[model samples]
Target: MIAVVQRVYEASVKVDGEIIGSIGNGLLVFLCVENRDTDDKVTYMSEKILNLRIFEDNNGKMSKSLQDINGDMLIISQFTLAGDCSKGRRPDFTEAAKPDAAKETYNKFIEDVSSKINGNTAIGIFGADMKVSLINDGPVTMIIKR
Candidate 1:
Protein backbone atom coordinates (compact mmCIF):
# COMPACT_ATOMS: atom_id res chain seq x y z
CA MET A 1 0.00 0.00 0.00
CA ILE A 2 1.20 3.52 -0.82
CA ALA A 3 -0.27 6.96 -0.30
CA VAL A 4 0.71 10.48 -1.24
CA VAL A 5 -0.93 12.62 1.42
CA GLN A 6 -1.16 16.37 1.04
CA ARG A 7 -2.49 18.88 3.53
CA VAL A 8 -5.08 21.02 1.83
CA TYR A 9 -7.36 23.90 2.68
CA GLU A 10 -9.89 22.53 0.18
CA ALA A 11 -10.12 19.78 -2.43
CA SER A 12 -12.56 18.34 -4.92
CA VAL A 13 -12.90 15.65 -7.58
CA LYS A 14 -14.85 15.92 -10.78
CA VAL A 15 -16.00 13.27 -13.22
CA ASP A 16 -17.51 14.00 -16.60
CA GLY A 17 -17.85 17.68 -15.69
CA GLU A 18 -19.70 16.75 -12.48
CA ILE A 19 -18.28 17.14 -9.04
CA ILE A 20 -18.18 13.79 -7.25
CA GLY A 21 -16.41 14.38 -3.95
CA SER A 22 -14.96 17.38 -2.15
CA ILE A 23 -13.52 18.48 1.18
CA GLY A 24 -12.38 21.45 3.27
CA ASN A 25 -9.51 21.93 5.71
CA GLY A 26 -8.23 18.41 5.22
CA LEU A 27 -5.83 16.04 3.63
CA LEU A 28 -5.98 14.94 -0.01
CA VAL A 29 -4.81 11.38 -0.39
CA PHE A 30 -3.65 9.69 -3.60
CA LEU A 31 -3.50 5.99 -2.82
CA CYS A 32 -2.24 2.93 -4.66
CA VAL A 33 -2.57 -0.74 -3.86
CA GLU A 34 0.25 -3.07 -4.77
CA ASN A 35 0.02 -6.76 -5.61
CA ARG A 36 1.64 -7.70 -2.34
CA ASP A 37 -0.52 -5.49 -0.13
CA THR A 38 -2.47 -7.22 2.63
CA ASP A 39 -5.39 -6.31 4.89
CA ASP A 40 -2.95 -5.53 7.68
CA LYS A 41 -1.13 -3.07 5.40
CA VAL A 42 -4.38 -1.29 4.66
CA THR A 43 -5.20 -0.93 8.35
CA TYR A 44 -1.77 0.34 9.21
CA MET A 45 -1.61 2.87 6.37
CA SER A 46 -5.04 4.24 7.22
CA GLU A 47 -4.12 4.66 10.87
CA LYS A 48 -0.85 6.34 10.04
CA ILE A 49 -2.32 8.84 7.60
CA LEU A 50 -5.16 9.73 9.96
CA ASN A 51 -2.91 10.30 12.95
CA LEU A 52 -0.07 12.04 11.17
CA ARG A 53 0.90 15.21 13.03
CA ILE A 54 1.33 17.46 10.04
CA PHE A 55 -1.22 20.07 11.00
CA GLU A 56 -0.11 23.02 13.05
CA ASP A 57 -1.05 23.81 16.63
CA ASN A 58 -1.65 27.20 18.31
CA ASN A 59 2.06 27.72 18.77
CA GLY A 60 2.58 27.30 15.01
CA LYS A 61 4.19 23.94 15.47
CA MET A 62 3.19 20.98 13.38
CA SER A 63 1.74 19.01 16.25
CA LYS A 64 -1.90 18.45 15.46
CA SER A 65 -3.23 15.27 13.95
CA LEU A 66 -6.23 15.17 11.61
CA GLN A 67 -8.23 13.49 14.39
CA ASP A 68 -7.34 16.28 16.79
CA ILE A 69 -8.40 19.01 14.36
CA ASN A 70 -11.44 17.12 13.09
CA GLY A 71 -10.33 17.59 9.48
CA ASP A 72 -11.86 16.10 6.34
CA MET A 73 -10.26 13.50 4.06
CA LEU A 74 -10.37 13.05 0.31
CA ILE A 75 -9.13 9.65 -0.84
CA ILE A 76 -8.45 8.84 -4.48
CA SER A 77 -7.18 5.65 -6.08
CA GLN A 78 -4.11 6.24 -8.27
CA PHE A 79 -2.52 3.08 -9.58
CA THR A 80 0.34 5.04 -11.12
CA LEU A 81 1.87 5.38 -7.72
CA ALA A 82 3.17 1.88 -8.22
CA GLY A 83 4.66 2.71 -11.61
CA ASP A 84 8.36 2.09 -11.98
CA CYS A 85 10.43 4.02 -14.52
CA SER A 86 13.90 3.17 -13.29
CA LYS A 87 14.78 0.84 -16.09
CA GLY A 88 13.16 1.65 -19.42
CA ARG A 89 11.82 4.73 -21.15
CA ARG A 90 8.28 3.52 -20.53
CA PRO A 91 6.94 3.13 -17.02
CA ASP A 92 6.14 -0.37 -15.79
CA PHE A 93 3.08 -1.04 -13.64
CA THR A 94 3.81 -4.68 -12.94
CA GLU A 95 3.67 -4.08 -9.17
CA ALA A 96 0.20 -2.61 -9.27
CA ALA A 97 -2.66 -4.85 -8.17
CA LYS A 98 -5.18 -6.08 -10.73
CA PRO A 99 -8.34 -4.01 -11.10
CA ASP A 100 -10.53 -6.35 -9.05
CA ALA A 101 -8.02 -6.73 -6.25
CA ALA A 102 -7.13 -3.06 -6.27
CA LYS A 103 -10.76 -2.01 -6.03
CA GLU A 104 -11.32 -4.36 -3.11
CA THR A 105 -8.39 -2.93 -1.20
CA TYR A 106 -9.31 0.60 -2.14
CA ASN A 107 -12.84 0.09 -0.83
CA LYS A 108 -11.46 -1.41 2.34
CA PHE A 109 -9.25 1.62 2.87
CA ILE A 110 -12.11 4.05 2.28
CA GLU A 111 -14.38 2.03 4.59
CA ASP A 112 -11.74 1.93 7.30
CA VAL A 113 -11.19 5.69 7.25
CA SER A 114 -14.86 6.54 6.84
CA SER A 115 -15.68 4.38 9.83
CA LYS A 116 -13.26 6.44 11.87
CA ILE A 117 -14.10 9.91 10.54
CA ASN A 118 -17.75 9.52 9.64
CA GLY A 119 -19.13 12.26 7.38
CA ASN A 120 -15.78 13.92 6.93
CA THR A 121 -14.50 11.32 4.50
CA ALA A 122 -14.93 11.81 0.75
CA ILE A 123 -13.82 9.54 -2.08
CA GLY A 124 -13.32 9.58 -5.84
CA ILE A 125 -14.81 6.81 -7.96
CA PHE A 126 -12.60 3.73 -7.99
CA GLY A 127 -12.05 3.49 -11.75
CA ALA A 128 -13.29 6.75 -13.13
CA ASP A 129 -11.49 9.48 -15.04
CA MET A 130 -11.23 11.87 -12.12
CA LYS A 131 -10.18 15.51 -12.18
CA VAL A 132 -8.92 16.53 -8.78
CA SER A 133 -8.37 20.10 -7.56
CA LEU A 134 -6.94 21.34 -4.31
CA ILE A 135 -5.45 24.31 -2.51
CA ASN A 136 -2.43 22.65 -0.94
CA ASP A 137 -1.90 23.99 2.56
CA GLY A 138 1.71 24.63 3.53
CA PRO A 139 2.58 22.59 0.47
CA VAL A 140 2.95 19.84 3.04
CA THR A 141 3.00 16.42 1.44
CA MET A 142 4.13 13.01 2.56
CA ILE A 143 4.69 9.75 0.75
CA ILE A 144 3.59 6.91 2.99
CA LYS A 145 4.10 3.26 2.11
CA ARG A 146 3.83 -0.13 3.73
Candidate 2:
Protein backbone atom coordinates (compact mmCIF):
# COMPACT_ATOMS: atom_id res chain seq x y z
CA MET A 1 0.00 0.00 0.00
CA ILE A 2 1.06 3.56 -0.66
CA ALA A 3 -0.29 6.87 0.57
CA VAL A 4 0.40 10.52 -0.22
CA VAL A 5 -0.50 12.41 2.94
CA GLN A 6 -1.00 16.14 2.78
CA ARG A 7 -1.82 18.38 5.69
CA VAL A 8 -4.70 20.65 4.73
CA TYR A 9 -6.72 23.39 6.33
CA GLU A 10 -9.72 22.02 4.48
CA ALA A 11 -10.41 19.44 1.77
CA SER A 12 -13.30 18.13 -0.23
CA VAL A 13 -14.15 15.66 -2.99
CA LYS A 14 -16.82 16.09 -5.59
CA VAL A 15 -18.36 13.61 -7.98
CA ASP A 16 -20.69 14.60 -10.80
CA GLY A 17 -20.97 18.06 -9.35
CA GLU A 18 -22.01 16.73 -5.95
CA ILE A 19 -19.86 16.87 -2.90
CA ILE A 20 -19.09 13.39 -1.63
CA GLY A 21 -16.67 13.94 1.25
CA SER A 22 -14.94 16.80 3.05
CA ILE A 23 -12.84 17.62 6.10
CA GLY A 24 -11.48 20.55 8.09
CA ASN A 25 -8.02 21.16 9.55
CA GLY A 26 -6.83 17.67 8.76
CA LEU A 27 -5.05 15.46 6.30
CA LEU A 28 -5.94 14.61 2.74
CA VAL A 29 -4.75 11.08 2.07
CA PHE A 30 -4.45 9.70 -1.42
CA LEU A 31 -4.21 5.96 -0.86
CA CYS A 32 -3.33 3.18 -3.27
CA VAL A 33 -3.40 -0.58 -2.87
CA GLU A 34 -0.81 -2.69 -4.57
CA ASN A 35 -1.08 -6.36 -5.51
CA ARG A 36 1.10 -7.34 -2.55
CA ASP A 37 -0.70 -5.30 0.09
CA THR A 38 -2.36 -7.05 3.04
CA ASP A 39 -4.17 -6.38 6.27
CA ASP A 40 -0.88 -5.76 8.05
CA LYS A 41 -0.10 -2.93 5.65
CA VAL A 42 -3.42 -1.33 6.33
CA THR A 43 -2.94 -1.60 10.10
CA TYR A 44 0.52 -0.14 10.02
CA MET A 45 -0.38 2.71 7.66
CA SER A 46 -3.37 3.72 9.74
CA GLU A 47 -1.38 3.83 12.94
CA LYS A 48 1.46 5.70 11.30
CA ILE A 49 -0.82 8.30 9.76
CA LEU A 50 -2.83 8.96 12.90
CA ASN A 51 0.28 9.23 15.07
CA LEU A 52 2.39 11.25 12.64
CA ARG A 53 3.71 14.34 14.40
CA ILE A 54 3.16 16.77 11.55
CA PHE A 55 1.10 19.33 13.37
CA GLU A 56 2.88 22.15 15.18
CA ASP A 57 3.10 22.37 18.92
CA ASN A 58 2.50 25.49 21.01
CA ASN A 59 6.18 26.33 20.67
CA GLY A 60 5.93 26.14 16.84
CA LYS A 61 7.60 22.76 16.69
CA MET A 62 6.13 20.03 14.49
CA SER A 63 5.47 17.70 17.39
CA LYS A 64 1.74 17.07 17.57
CA SER A 65 0.00 14.14 15.97
CA LEU A 66 -3.38 14.28 14.32
CA GLN A 67 -4.93 12.69 17.37
CA ASP A 68 -3.35 15.32 19.58
CA ILE A 69 -4.92 18.08 17.48
CA ASN A 70 -8.27 16.32 17.07
CA GLY A 71 -8.05 16.64 13.31
CA ASP A 72 -10.13 14.94 10.67
CA MET A 73 -9.09 12.98 7.57
CA LEU A 74 -10.18 12.83 3.97
CA ILE A 75 -9.20 9.57 2.33
CA ILE A 76 -9.26 9.11 -1.40
CA SER A 77 -8.56 5.98 -3.42
CA GLN A 78 -5.88 6.41 -6.07
CA PHE A 79 -4.51 3.30 -7.75
CA THR A 80 -2.07 5.41 -9.77
CA LEU A 81 0.33 5.38 -6.84
CA ALA A 82 1.42 1.99 -8.17
CA GLY A 83 1.95 3.28 -11.67
CA ASP A 84 5.31 2.49 -13.25
CA CYS A 85 6.75 5.04 -15.64
CA SER A 86 10.21 3.59 -15.99
CA LYS A 87 9.59 2.43 -19.52
CA GLY A 88 8.37 4.40 -22.49
CA ARG A 89 6.18 7.49 -22.15
CA ARG A 90 3.11 5.79 -20.73
CA PRO A 91 2.74 4.60 -17.18
CA ASP A 92 1.73 1.04 -16.41
CA PHE A 93 -0.49 0.02 -13.51
CA THR A 94 0.24 -3.70 -13.66
CA GLU A 95 1.42 -3.76 -10.06
CA ALA A 96 -1.79 -2.28 -8.77
CA ALA A 97 -4.33 -4.68 -7.29
CA LYS A 98 -7.31 -5.76 -9.33
CA PRO A 99 -10.50 -3.81 -8.84
CA ASP A 100 -12.11 -6.17 -6.36
CA ALA A 101 -9.03 -6.69 -4.23
CA ALA A 102 -8.10 -3.04 -4.34
CA LYS A 103 -11.57 -1.99 -3.29
CA GLU A 104 -11.55 -4.42 -0.37
CA THR A 105 -8.17 -3.30 0.83
CA TYR A 106 -9.03 0.33 0.35
CA ASN A 107 -12.22 -0.04 2.35
CA LYS A 108 -10.36 -1.88 5.07
CA PHE A 109 -7.77 0.86 5.21
CA ILE A 110 -10.46 3.50 5.61
CA GLU A 111 -12.16 1.43 8.32
CA ASP A 112 -8.90 1.06 10.18
CA VAL A 113 -8.22 4.80 10.02
CA SER A 114 -11.74 5.58 11.14
CA SER A 115 -11.44 3.22 14.08
CA LYS A 116 -8.23 4.83 15.24
CA ILE A 117 -9.32 8.45 14.73
CA ASN A 118 -12.61 8.10 16.58
CA GLY A 119 -14.58 8.19 13.32
CA ASN A 120 -13.47 11.66 12.26
CA THR A 121 -12.79 10.70 8.67
CA ALA A 122 -14.54 10.74 5.32
CA ILE A 123 -13.83 8.70 2.19
CA GLY A 124 -14.24 9.22 -1.52
CA ILE A 125 -16.06 6.62 -3.55
CA PHE A 126 -13.86 3.78 -4.71
CA GLY A 127 -13.04 3.85 -8.44
CA ALA A 128 -15.00 6.99 -8.96
CA ASP A 129 -14.04 10.01 -11.04
CA MET A 130 -13.49 12.45 -8.23
CA LYS A 131 -12.50 16.10 -8.08
CA VAL A 132 -10.52 16.88 -4.95
CA SER A 133 -9.90 20.40 -3.69
CA LEU A 134 -7.84 21.40 -0.70
CA ILE A 135 -6.30 24.33 1.06
CA ASN A 136 -2.94 22.78 1.88
CA ASP A 137 -1.70 23.74 5.31
CA GLY A 138 2.01 24.51 5.60
CA PRO A 139 2.31 22.80 2.23
CA VAL A 140 3.26 19.74 4.26
CA THR A 141 3.13 16.54 2.23
CA MET A 142 4.64 13.11 2.72
CA ILE A 143 4.51 9.82 0.91
CA ILE A 144 4.50 6.45 2.67
CA LYS A 145 4.68 2.96 1.23
CA ARG A 146 4.39 -0.49 2.82
Candidate 3:
Protein backbone atom coordinates (compact mmCIF):
# COMPACT_ATOMS: atom_id res chain seq x y z
CA MET A 1 0.00 0.00 0.00
CA ILE A 2 1.13 3.57 -0.70
CA ALA A 3 -0.21 6.89 0.48
CA VAL A 4 0.45 10.44 -0.52
CA VAL A 5 -0.66 12.45 2.46
CA GLN A 6 -1.05 16.19 2.32
CA ARG A 7 -1.86 18.52 5.18
CA VAL A 8 -4.86 20.49 4.07
CA TYR A 9 -7.07 23.28 5.29
CA GLU A 10 -9.87 21.58 3.40
CA ALA A 11 -10.43 19.07 0.63
CA SER A 12 -13.30 17.54 -1.33
CA VAL A 13 -14.02 14.99 -4.03
CA LYS A 14 -16.70 15.28 -6.68
CA VAL A 15 -18.16 12.73 -9.04
CA ASP A 16 -20.41 13.84 -11.86
CA GLY A 17 -20.57 17.30 -10.33
CA GLU A 18 -21.83 15.94 -7.05
CA ILE A 19 -19.77 16.15 -3.90
CA ILE A 20 -19.21 12.70 -2.49
CA GLY A 21 -16.65 13.24 0.23
CA SER A 22 -15.09 16.21 1.96
CA ILE A 23 -12.92 17.19 4.94
CA GLY A 24 -11.68 20.26 6.74
CA ASN A 25 -8.57 21.13 8.69
CA GLY A 26 -7.00 17.74 8.32
CA LEU A 27 -5.10 15.50 5.94
CA LEU A 28 -5.90 14.57 2.38
CA VAL A 29 -4.76 11.00 1.73
CA PHE A 30 -4.21 9.89 -1.85
CA LEU A 31 -3.84 6.14 -1.66
CA CYS A 32 -2.61 3.41 -3.99
CA VAL A 33 -2.64 -0.33 -3.69
CA GLU A 34 0.04 -2.45 -5.26
CA ASN A 35 -0.01 -6.08 -6.40
CA ARG A 36 2.19 -7.01 -3.48
CA ASP A 37 0.20 -5.38 -0.69
CA THR A 38 -1.65 -7.11 2.11
CA ASP A 39 -3.66 -6.24 5.19
CA ASP A 40 -0.44 -5.86 7.14
CA LYS A 41 0.58 -3.08 4.81
CA VAL A 42 -2.75 -1.39 5.37
CA THR A 43 -2.31 -1.59 9.12
CA TYR A 44 1.16 -0.12 9.01
CA MET A 45 0.16 2.64 6.64
CA SER A 46 -2.87 3.56 8.70
CA GLU A 47 -0.99 3.79 11.97
CA LYS A 48 1.83 5.74 10.43
CA ILE A 49 -0.46 8.37 8.91
CA LEU A 50 -2.70 8.78 11.93
CA ASN A 51 0.30 9.41 14.14
CA LEU A 52 2.27 11.43 11.65
CA ARG A 53 3.25 14.85 13.04
CA ILE A 54 2.59 17.28 10.24
CA PHE A 55 0.44 19.87 11.93
CA GLU A 56 1.80 22.66 14.12
CA ASP A 57 1.62 22.70 17.87
CA ASN A 58 0.97 25.60 20.21
CA ASN A 59 4.70 26.00 20.65
CA GLY A 60 5.00 26.77 16.93
CA LYS A 61 6.50 23.43 16.12
CA MET A 62 5.35 20.66 13.81
CA SER A 63 4.40 18.31 16.57
CA LYS A 64 0.73 17.50 16.36
CA SER A 65 -0.63 14.25 15.04
CA LEU A 66 -4.03 13.78 13.41
CA GLN A 67 -5.29 11.96 16.47
CA ASP A 68 -3.87 14.68 18.74
CA ILE A 69 -5.66 17.45 16.86
CA ASN A 70 -8.86 15.47 16.30
CA GLY A 71 -8.54 16.07 12.62
CA ASP A 72 -10.52 14.61 9.73
CA MET A 73 -9.30 12.72 6.65
CA LEU A 74 -10.22 12.60 3.01
CA ILE A 75 -9.10 9.48 1.16
CA ILE A 76 -8.91 9.12 -2.60
CA SER A 77 -7.98 6.05 -4.60
CA GLN A 78 -5.25 6.64 -7.17
CA PHE A 79 -3.66 3.53 -8.65
CA THR A 80 -1.52 5.74 -10.84
CA LEU A 81 0.74 6.31 -7.90
CA ALA A 82 2.23 2.96 -8.77
CA GLY A 83 2.97 4.03 -12.34
CA ASP A 84 6.34 3.09 -13.78
CA CYS A 85 8.02 5.68 -16.01
CA SER A 86 11.51 4.29 -16.39
CA LYS A 87 11.25 3.15 -20.00
CA GLY A 88 8.60 5.02 -21.89
CA ARG A 89 6.90 8.35 -22.48
CA ARG A 90 3.69 6.81 -21.11
CA PRO A 91 3.70 5.66 -17.52
CA ASP A 92 2.90 1.99 -16.96
CA PHE A 93 0.43 0.70 -14.41
CA THR A 94 1.98 -2.73 -14.12
CA GLU A 95 2.73 -2.36 -10.44
CA ALA A 96 -0.77 -1.37 -9.52
CA ALA A 97 -3.10 -3.95 -8.07
CA LYS A 98 -5.98 -5.18 -10.19
CA PRO A 99 -9.13 -3.10 -9.69
CA ASP A 100 -11.13 -5.58 -7.61
CA ALA A 101 -8.24 -6.37 -5.35
CA ALA A 102 -7.19 -2.77 -5.08
CA LYS A 103 -10.70 -1.70 -4.14
CA GLU A 104 -10.81 -4.26 -1.37
CA THR A 105 -7.44 -3.12 -0.12
CA TYR A 106 -8.62 0.46 -0.24
CA ASN A 107 -11.73 -0.44 1.75
CA LYS A 108 -9.71 -2.19 4.38
CA PHE A 109 -7.40 0.76 4.75
CA ILE A 110 -10.37 3.10 5.07
CA GLU A 111 -11.90 0.84 7.67
CA ASP A 112 -8.70 0.89 9.66
CA VAL A 113 -8.56 4.67 9.51
CA SER A 114 -12.24 5.02 10.38
CA SER A 115 -11.86 2.91 13.48
CA LYS A 116 -8.96 4.97 14.79
CA ILE A 117 -10.27 8.40 13.85
CA ASN A 118 -13.79 7.83 15.17
CA GLY A 119 -15.27 7.58 11.67
CA ASN A 120 -14.06 11.02 10.64
CA THR A 121 -12.65 9.64 7.44
CA ALA A 122 -14.26 10.56 4.14
CA ILE A 123 -13.47 8.71 0.93
CA GLY A 124 -13.88 8.94 -2.79
CA ILE A 125 -15.59 6.16 -4.73
CA PHE A 126 -13.20 3.28 -5.32
CA GLY A 127 -13.15 3.27 -9.12
CA ALA A 128 -15.04 6.39 -10.02
CA ASP A 129 -13.85 9.33 -12.03
CA MET A 130 -13.34 11.88 -9.29
CA LYS A 131 -12.58 15.56 -9.21
CA VAL A 132 -10.49 16.46 -6.19
CA SER A 133 -9.94 19.94 -4.80
CA LEU A 134 -8.02 21.17 -1.81
CA ILE A 135 -6.42 24.10 -0.06
CA ASN A 136 -3.04 22.70 0.91
CA ASP A 137 -1.83 23.98 4.26
CA GLY A 138 1.88 24.61 4.41
CA PRO A 139 1.92 22.69 1.15
CA VAL A 140 3.02 19.81 3.36
CA THR A 141 2.96 16.49 1.56
CA MET A 142 4.34 13.02 2.24
CA ILE A 143 4.54 9.76 0.28
CA ILE A 144 4.51 6.65 2.44
CA LYS A 145 4.50 2.95 1.52
CA ARG A 146 4.40 -0.36 3.29
- Give per-model TM-scores: 0.98, 0.98, 0.97
Pairs in clash, predicted candidate 2: none
lDDT of 3 at 99: 97
For candidate 3, what is the lDDT?
0.93
Considering every candidate listed, which one attains the maximal lDDT? 1
Of the two candidates 2 and 3, the one with more favorable lDDT, higher being better, is 2
lDDT of 1 at 61: 99
Q: Score candidate 1 by lDDT.
A: 0.95
Query: TM-score of predicted model 3?
Result: 0.97
lDDT of 3 by residue, 50-135 (tens): 99999899887999999999999999999999998998699999999999999999999999999899337899999899999999
Residue-by-residue lDDT tens digits, candidate 1, 14-131? 9999999999998999999999999999999989999999999999999988998999999999999999999979999999999999999999999999988733999999989999
Clashing residue pairs for model 3: none
Task: Evaluate residue 49 in candidate 3 and report its C-alpha lDDT on the 0 to 100 scale.
Answer: 97
- Per-candidate Cα lDDT values, in order, are 0.95, 0.94, 0.93
**lDDT score, candidate 1, position 94:** 97
lDDT-based ranking: 1, 2, 3
